[model samples]
Target chain A: MNGIHDMGGMHGFGPIVREADEPVFHHEWEGKALALARIALAGGLFNLDEFRHVMERMPPVQYLSISYYERWLEGAIALLAEKGVISADEFTARLTALAEAGS
Target chain B: MTADAHGDADVALRVRALESLLLEKGLVESPAIDEIIDLFENRLGPQNGARVVARAWSDPEFKARLLANATDAIVEMGYEAVQGEDMVVVENTPRVHNLVVCTLCSCFPWATLGLPPVWYKSAPYRSRAASDPRGVLLEFGTAVADEAEVRVWDSNAELRYMVLPERPAGTDAMGEDELLALVTRDSMIGVTRALAP
Candidate 1:
């Protein structure tokens, strides 16, 4: 569970950035992602502890690269697959379908 | 699309897929998701926390109860949900200040504070808060006296924290609404002091 996500007191990231009038969620996608996460947890799909554990285990590079709700969505997908709610093949197929439709 | 844009689209797709998948499987209801989002997006926020701080400033009994049993006190105010089940309200006085951070991830009191700010989850804050509390506070434009002790709290799944910032001087007659106006999100998070009227 010890990973780069546990980043208290280590350094070099930079100063905290504050916007003039920040909304609760920066993107519409982020709101949906967060909603999915909350609903998934409420429905007994996965608990907070389990979700937090997997989030900590996310690839360090990805952790720093993605946005906050992006991480939440990724962790939710990983949990859904892990818990057998959705199979790995189905997950990949959906992603591929989405990408294909976009192009 | 750029990689980042593609990534964003990908996440959006996954969220939609997961929601439908759960609904099809009878695991969750669609309205529940809508309600949760509505709560965080509209009904909950630091404004909720500001109300609690304002009450504590005006009522000594409430402040004592809040400091002694934060979860109960906060719940009594009708703010109860995920990530806020167990809370510790640390008081800021002349000699001590408190800062809350979740080193492992963003563990926040979402029921009261709504979602955390982007910076609260940034690598910069996670890595530097505890090591340079004074410096971090300074960046937030809060310069604590050299003699005051800075206490950093690490929030987790089991317990979360919010700072009970010092009541600023010269507002003895202000009502709760006026007091609430002076309470900002940063003060509850301990990055800055509550504003003065």
Candidate 2:
């Protein structure tokens, strides 16, 4: 898939923004997202190629707008639902409940 | 918290939701998640790549093997894992420099180099790395000589790459441990040279 993710050679995005003294992860959630993705692949819910393909299928505008780990989170959730490990309604209800509790 | 903070919270909530659902369904365990996080944070990282680069600098035979067959050579040093199974180590000689990028996505040698930096996966970098490598290097404060040829390696899902940076001069007296300090993550990624001893 020649999505926006295949960004080689086309220009004008901007200069590279290099962070100083960057840590392994910026947010706590980012690490969790990474861990979930790795676990999903290791458990054979999806192969590495399938994982990359799902991320590539993300809507281009949203794909470019979201942060890196957020993409991981999105891909992992999509795979879990697709693999029948979890249902979309179950995920949505849980998300709503969590959001309400926090608010 | 600002608007950006609210946005982050929303994404955080989504991740929490996914995690909880997986746990409830018995698809994953909490302890397992922590173990994965700990592995990447503590056990696997650029320190492993630094060790490989340092050993190559001090031993000519190892360097030859590393350049010839990077996957087996790196595994011999005990740095083999999922994303790094197929490895290719490109050397930077006096006349040629090598830079690595994953044009399709963020395909990196995770077993050795750990997770990539945000800039490495950013659009500007993914786009310009292969096309305008010298210009990209300049932004990283790395200026290759005009006479040297710049070679860009586009890593993909199956294969990954790491740069074998030239050992700095005046380091003949330095041992492997000392050499490790001179080898940095950027050097292995070909964004910059090894630190001068």
DockQ scores for all the models shown?
A: 0.61, 0.60
Candidate 2 residue B9 C-alpha distance from true site, Å? 1.1
Report the C-alpha lDDT of model 1 over B1-197, residue by residue, as the tens digit.
Answer: 01242455566777777766767788777787777778878998999999999999999999999999999999999888565469899999999999988877788887678888888888888898889889999999999999999999988878889999999999998999999999998899999999978
lDDT of 2 by residue, A1-103 (tens): 5677879888789999988878888888988989888877888889888888778888887787788898888888887788788778888889889988888
TM-score of 2: 0.95
Q: What is the lDDT of candidate 2?
A: 0.86
Record all residue pairs in model 1 with backbone atoms less than 3 Å apart, i.e. clashing.
Answer: A7-B126, A9-B127
Error of model 2, residue B40, in angstroms: 1.2
